[model samples]
Target: MWRTPLEQTATAALFLGIIMSQIVGEGSAVKVLSQPGQQVTLLCSYNYEDNTHIPQLSVQWRGPNNQLLCHYIKHKAYQNCTRGYTISYSPSSITLTIQHVHMEDFGAHVCSVSKPHEFSDYSMELARMSEYVTSAPKSGGDQSGSTWTLIIFHTLLSVCM
Candidate 1:
C-alpha cells in the first residue's frame, strides 16, 4: 500500500522528535564538597531560546545510596531532610540547600530537572571531611567525656601533623 505525502511527512517528523529528545535530555554535571556538620548547597540551571516557552523546572535530589532526599514540584518543596534542607528555584536556576552535613551524607548525589518534553540533570560527589570541628567543653563534664575529647583532639592533631 502507498502512503500519502502528508502521512509520510508526519511519520518523519515524529521520528525526529524522539531523536532530539534523547540528545537534549542528557544535561551537565557538577561536583561539590563540604565538611561534616556544615551547610552545603547544590545548583541547577537551564536555558531556553524562547523565554516564554520555558517549561516548569522540576528538581530532584538523590543521596549516595540512591535515596530520594528531596524534590521540588510546582514551586513547592517536598523534602525528607534528615537535618533540615531547603529548595529554591527560579526560571533559570534551582538551588538545594542542605544543613548539618554528616558522614552518611557523603558520596555521590544526583540532581535532575524535568521541563516540558525535555529533561536535564547533574551530579555532585561529596568528599570525606578532612577534619572535624571541636565544640566548647561542657560544664561539669564526666571523666568519659574528657577521654573522648582527648581522643578526638589527637586525631585532629595527627591529621594536621
Candidate 2:
C-alpha cells in the first residue's frame, strides 16, 4: 500500500504537541464518511482568552502526503493550493475546503497555526463510505446493517463531543 509522506517540517509540529489530540473541547480521531466528488471542509478552531489583536499569526493546511495546500500569514493568503482546494481563515478558526474529493484524498489532512513560540494544530481523516464499509468486517449479516450501525456509532460519537 502507498504511504503518505512523514517529513518533518514546520507543519510537522502539528502532530507533536497533541500527537493527534484535538482541541480542548472537540471530537477525537474522527473518520468523516463521504462520497466521491463531494465537497468537504475541514475546520480547525481555537478560542482566545480575550479578543486581543493578533500579530503575525500563520496557518497552513497540508494534505495527506504532507503537501502544503495553502498558507496564510497575518491577513495575507498564499496560493500554494492548485489541486482543486481552497482555504480561508478568520480570527478564531481556519478552514480547508476540497472542491471535489477523490479516493486519493481519503486520508489524514492536517491544519497548523502558529505565532512566535506558541502553536496549535490538528488533523482529521476522511474516508469514503463504500471503502469504509468494505474494510470494516461485521460479525455477521448483510453489509447494509453493518453500515447503518457504523453510521449510528459515528453519529453518537459526534453528538457526545
Candidate 3:
C-alpha cells in the first residue's frame, strides 16, 4: 500500500506523542516546614497518567555534604533514619521528620516515587531558626509579658492603619 504525505506525517506525529508521554516523568513541588523540637514534615505530591497500579515511594534526607542521612522505602518496613531522624510515607506523599533538629539536618531532603519503569524526584532545603521567642514568661518573672502585650497592640494598630 502507498501512503500519502499527510498520512505519513500524521502517523509519525502520533508515534512521537506516545513515545514522549512514556519518556516524560511527573514531579511535584517540595515543601518544607520548621518546628522547635518535634520532627519537621516534608510533603511532596505528584500525579501521573497511569494510576491503575500502586507506585513505590521513597524519601531521603541528605546532609550538606550529600550524605544520605535517612531513607525510607514503601515495601521495606525498616527505615534508615539518621541517629536523630525519622521517615514515613503514604501512597502519594512522603514525610521526613527529624526527631531533634540538628545543624546537619538543615539541608536538602529528596522525595521520589517510582513505578515499574518510571520515577520522579524532588528536593528542598530545611532551614533552622537561630533564635526563637517564647509566648510569655512563667510565674510573671518580670514585666516582659506586659512589654510583649504592648508590642502586639502596636503591631496590630499599625497593620490596621
Candidate 4:
C-alpha cells in the first residue's frame, strides 16, 4: 500500500495515519499510519449551491498545540508561513501543505474560517498507523496491538508444531 520510496519513510513498524477531513466540524479523530518526508495537504473546502457566488472568507492553519502556520484573511495580504509548510487559497478552499513531514509534525491540525454572518472550524489529527486496517483488537478490552500480534504469532507457531 506504500507508493513512495522506502528511503523517504524507512520505518516498517512506524505506521502513519493520514486522517481525512471533509467539512469536519471539529477534527478528524483517527490514528496515524503515514510515512515521514511525504507531503500532505489538509484542505478546508466549502461548496455553494451556485458556483458563481463567492463569499468573503478568512482562514488560519494551526499546527499541534496551537502553533500558527499561516492565515489568509479576507481582502488582506497578511501572510505567514513557516518552514516546511505552505498555505494557498482559492475561491472554494484553503489548503495547508506540509512538506518533509516528521514525527514532530504529527498531531492535530485545525483550520479556522470566518465568513459573512457565519463562523466555522475544521481539524485533522494525525497518529501512528496499524497493520489492522479496521480496528485494533482489545485484550479484555485493554491490550496493546503489539501484544496481540505476539499472541497471535505464538498461537500460529504452536499449531504448526
> Which candidate order results from sorting by TM-score in descending order?
2, 4, 1, 3
The 10-residue segment of model 2 with minimum total lDDT is: 2-11
Q: How high is the CA lDDT of each candidate model?
A: 0.57, 0.61, 0.51, 0.60
- Worst lDDT run of 10 residues, candidate 4, spans 10-19
> For residues 36-146, could you state the per-residue lDDT of candidate 4 as single tens digits?
666666666655212665446678889887988887775666667888899988776777877777787788878787777767777666544333334356545776776
Assess every candidate by TM-score: 0.55, 0.63, 0.51, 0.59
Q: Please provide, for model 2 over 124-159, each residue's C-alpha lDDT reduced to its tens digit, 9 standing for 90 to 100.
A: 777565433233454775677656656654444344
Clashing pairs in 3: none
Off by over 4 Å in 1: 1-28, 48-50, 53-55, 75-83, 132-161
Return the top candidate by lDDT: 2
Could you give candidate 3's per-residue lDDT for residues 64-125 as a string of tens digits?
A: 57887777765566578767766666555555656666666666666555555667776655
Supply the global lDDT for candidate 4. Answer: 0.60
lDDT of 1 at 54: 51
Q: How close is candidate 1 to the true structure, as a TM-score?
A: 0.55
Winner by lDDT between candidate 4 and candidate 2: 2
Cα displacement (Å) at residue 45, model 3: 2.3
Q: Model 3 off-target regions past 4 Å? A: 1-38, 48-50, 55-58, 76-78, 130-161
The residue-by-residue lDDT of candidate 1 on 118-140, one tens digit each, is: 67666666654334345555787
